[model samples]
Target: MSAAASSPASPAALTSSSRLAWLDALRGIGALAVVAEHMLPWFVPSLRPYWFSLGVYGIFVFFLVSGYIIPASLERHGDVRAFWISRFFRLYPLYLAIIVLVLALAWWVPVREAVVRDGSAVAAHATMLLDVVGIGGVADTMWTLSYEMVFYLVVTALFLTRGHERSGTWAIVFAVAAVLVGLVASGAVFGGGWPAYVSCAVFVLGLTGVVLGRLRTVSACLLGVMAVACLLLSSRVPWLGAAVLAVMFAGTAIYRWERGTGPLWPVAVTAALVVVAPVWAIESGWWWVRADVWLTTIALAAATFAGGMALRGRRLPRVLVWFGLISYSLYLVHHPLLKYFVQVSGDLRQAALPYQLLMTAVALAVIIGASALTYRFVEKPMQDLGRRVSRRCRGGLQGGGEARVPGEDAGDDRVLGHQERQVPHGVGDHVGQGDTVG
Candidate 1:
């Protein structure tokens, strides 16, 4: 027998998987796009029409990446407790800190007088459950987190039921059905705030397809084309935004195909074209010039795919990596922080361009500083704590499985062994069971 057959995986195997530098780089770039999208007015008047529109695409990219990576990680550990703990530690601490900081700023800072006067908004933001209330303008950006939280709960439920033959498939189908039903029920594709949740489900299914190795090259390419067309249509008919929404998942499929061929240069060129296509269409007065909005959408999808491919195996500088790591916090805090500063600084939006730039810069500085500190103290610690707690809980479940029931005798060993072997895969390593068999 080969030596490899003699050695079983030990616990150290947990951290053995090589880090994918490309994902990190993709994240870093995504974070920057988000920052630029939020801070667009500081640079150019021409961007005003496109800034928020393009900025949203950046957030979508972040979600797509999450769907891809989070499932992949869960597949590896095969321990639900460890997975939940890790997620908690990674998210809650920084999240809580941001909430507290926002509250303090609203209450104590003279600049936040207007915000404090209407403190109900601050209460909603602090709970991290604002999305359910349909209350906007507080932590307005935490809207995405609502989707993220839902996804997490769904994934956890799936993990618990991993042994079920058709759970994964049903989940994906149900999610897609939800989006369609939502679209139809809302009487608009993307307008009604509730319809956006469909995107979250679509994203989950798309990534689920990738993890399960069920995605087809032809279908992915076709989906890509459809998505591109939908993006163009979205500008005119917003409800069809679901089409544009499909691009992220379609891009994930394409990224897998590109990885197989190693011809990233061609992919990069194609991505650039995808980005510039809408812009050109708009400039040429193609009767669909308004569709230039899709340029940013398609470009970002392609860039994320290409950048993800390029970032493979390479460690980016710490600064870029740091941005990627704290991107969520940045996204959450930047807007509120900016609004507060603008209000305090007095008529920031009304100010001259230079003054606008200065105010924006100062706000960004505060955001960065606060985010960094939050990441260190809150996000990191909470993530660690969550992981530890999850592991302990999962370990107890595992122990019960293996610890022989008193006086049960060793004859029941086969059942215990089967249970041990059948645990859900880790968050990182498990091949997504096709949605059909989760």
Candidate 2:
């Protein structure tokens, strides 16, 4: 498709009820891959080697989807303040609930001391920049959030500058940078020192920039610089981190191409870079790790994403769609539940394979059930509240006036049901929205 064909002039130009069922299915599949990646080693030992680190593959797919959708959301709103508000409500409520629940459980369950430490945990929660600030994630999956935050900052910057269409260019730049960094700074980048403090400072500044981005250009530029700096200097795995962002932007570029916002050239270039950067980084920076395994996983992730795009016009299975709806909760809740399960089960490796498999099935059931409740009670309600508040806030700003963006209206209650309709200000959207941090 031509770039102009995909690029709508304004947010109002797109249909609010235009749901991407295939994207949801991809999310459903990705969520299951993540869950299996974490759970299978404990229950199905024989299958461990064959799993090929589905966690990484799943997250890569999630990031690509985030790249594709988040930019559209920002453009759809055209108001950074509203975008940020939507994002805050979408992600934090569930996140806070998970943190509180985990911490409470930790009191009795013997959680990791490093995760619960006063300085690290407090800093992590306060900023949600735990991994960037050199504090380990309180939850193992949270490291991805820091990267997601950085992506948001960059997107916001690009949005404010009206440079959002340059996603392909940015993707290529970052990918090449990753390759260069891998070659030159492979070993030196691993140790954390002053960079952590620098990251903390950048995050604070970036937050301020986003808040002021709509009001001033300089703030937006500052946010952009901070995001780049964090990715380059502060990321725990700087080369791979850069490559990951490149992959995400490549997804964004593809979205722009699909939407007719930009030319196909950048998308084509970005697609090539995305495939090559990870393989090159693995070869250069992570020589000790199995290159074939990592390469195969990346290939699968790319293929899965391509398949979803190809089938975007078709209907997907309801069960998979339902899984996508609750994906964020599942991603957040499952790991900790697995940890608790291991604690309660007490060295299940000694158990017979059949018994272990049965226990795994039960654990999956419990996790899914918990995720369902959390989605209904926590995720859904909070998201609804966010929309109401954001609408009101936008209305108040516009002096109690409601201007309908393209396809939004009183009869369009189904609008927000599509994850992409909601701009994932920082993380992506919920479920198919960018909450796939695991």
Candidate 3:
């Protein structure tokens, strides 16, 4: 979920924009990896490889990006109410659009059987906590949003309490929890759909109070508790849920380390624990979960992120940055669009290898083209609207000083990890005195 607002106004803001592009680029790369993981097995089976799961690798990169970026966002803004409002607009417009689209397309492209088609599903989607609430997403790719939402809630709470700087500590805690939980809990520990309903209620009420500025502190604390509990009790794979949070905070930990405010050792420890997390779990049956391959995937994602960090000062490939620009749209629409093609074209795997390759290229091109359109018409407009609202709110709160943040003037955001599109800010900006930065 990242986008640049417009061009920067000053030399300082331009430097901020340039450094942040690598993050958006990572998001783009991650989204395409996810698209390939979903696309290849269906239409180009022979080309699909299982050694390193493209989907998981992509998701990890996103998790890290969001972890690194979100703290800066909330911290710099320093207003929970405005932060949540912006997040809502950034994430929901396209998200709800896709949800409805998937549901409407169900007749032609039947909804995945995993979807529960009930009140629970409704509750889960509303909170964007589908996976943690033990509910299937209407859009198959939406599960990751659950973790992103949880991170937001938890980070907000930390910011409210001024404990936001302990990211490295949280990373290790979650990583250790991942291994511990994996041994004993493979599936949801919460028994049924009731957790979804209950948590949904909590989410709605908590947000309502926070937004309304009534018992705001209490509401945020409760929201954080509810989010963490949901993660621990109801995630489809308990350990993976824990591990995902760890990955996110690990991103933050890395950012802190880069800023010279935190230690790098915890990040290393967190990585080691997460890499070995699946090795002994009862639920570790997926081929990609194999110790060696999982380690490779985890290492590769880190390396990719690290590479971006290393090359932050230098100008990157225009194509990579362009990928970042349309990343959110690409992430959300590609899968369902692929399914629509599968419906029309049938399995191209049965055709000649060249035809399969050609059709795959065609499908990819169409997806990219479609994504570009949605980015223009849907995502960018909503992001701009969200920022305008944020500006008004901020002005009202601050009594008229410039409360602008990086990527605010230029459009950019959370990768969707959909952390949503149009980043509020990215890593490497000078620490401005503001809200607990993303």
Candidate 4:
């Protein structure tokens, strides 16, 4: 029987196949775009005007993919304990590894100390709620992880409330709210001492909700409140943060429509709103507006997602698939690698164009190689351990009986094995699955 048959809550059966090659390819492409967005400006300043903020495009694509895949994962499992277990194993190992490496490197590099000073670093490490608490990330790239965590909480709320199918409607609501708030709000909604306290409270309450799965409805409502509050009130850029969430839900809406779980109109409306929201949210005469970068980024992200949908069943290149496999590691490790490289090598903007390009290429190669090792040694092993632990936990919960939904275990063992081993791919929330980078 397939893992899903044996454990009906496991989405691994759906996610592990080669059928999702297009999504994997999109992840690989996004990973490259993010790396370029960060590395290019340093090496080719002149090109910065045109390619500035390409990271925005990369992250938008990441968020969309995350929105599409993560909810499916949660709903498939239909068990909060299993879902959280998968996520913890998928995300934390590599994340903790990177943080430790960054801190250790900081000890030797003066420039790195900025990440460790004050209580901010400790808070970030302790909670992973740093950005929501109005404290900066230990590494600049970590800000996205905070948003990813909130997305997970919000998804959990929807799941518990049995309202996940209405994701498209939520997308529209968030987008509209973002526009209105952008126009009227002069500053952050909770820009005071309350942010940290509120963040901590939400974190504690969210954990409690997960643990007390019997009170799912109440837990869901509480999580929803916390998530919405954090997004609207505590974010450094509430409008953009809300817009990002909308875009992610828009992706989720699209997935629901494709899977026959939702109406198409919401998806259509959400796509339209998301395309315009970022542009609308920006203040007039901002650099992004002046350069028309916002429009370009949105357009590129939309096109990429659409193309992936179009080519959903086709096989992608092995290299691209490999890139997707290690994309999360790439996202996590690349920024610090670039930071340290630039710090050690000094500014290379004054160098010849060829030399700058050469250095950029070298930096990318190193990051990729390092990512491969980490994926093999860290990500894969930890995920396997998570799977085993989840199996044990499920067995215990069910009094040693097979924990499965009815009638899902008739599949052939070979097919089940293939399905079970498929790695869930995406970026935005879970660094390995759909998490963020710098």
Best of the candidates, TM-score: 3
lDDT of 4: 0.64
User: What TM-score should be assigned to candidate 1?
Assistant: 0.58
lDDT string, candidate 3, 141-181, tens digits: 78878888999999887877777889999999999999988
- My TM-score estimates for the predictions, one after another, are 0.58, 0.83, 0.88, 0.83
Q: Comparing candidate 3 with candidate 4, which one achieves the higher TM-score?
A: 3
Give lDDT: candidate 2, residue 255. Answer: 75
lDDT of 2 by residue, 139-220 (tens): 6666677667778878877776767778888888888887776666543343344555555565566565555443345666
Please list the residue runs of candidate 1 whose C-alpha ends up more than 4 Å from where it truly belongs after superposition: 1-20, 42-52, 105-137, 163-183, 187-291, 315-317, 398-438
lDDT of candidate 1 over 312-416, digit per residue (tens)? 445567776667666666665666665566455654434577767766677778989876776666665665566456555543332111122222232221111
TM-score for candidate 4, residues paired by index? 0.83
lDDT of 4 by residue, 142-253 (tens): 6677667778888777776656768888989988876776777644667544566656666667666665454555665676677678778776667777777888888888
Query: If both were scored by TM-score, which would come out higher, candidate 1 or candidate 3?
Result: 3
Q: Which runs of model 3 end up more than 4 angstroms from their true locations?
A: 1-14, 280-284, 395-438
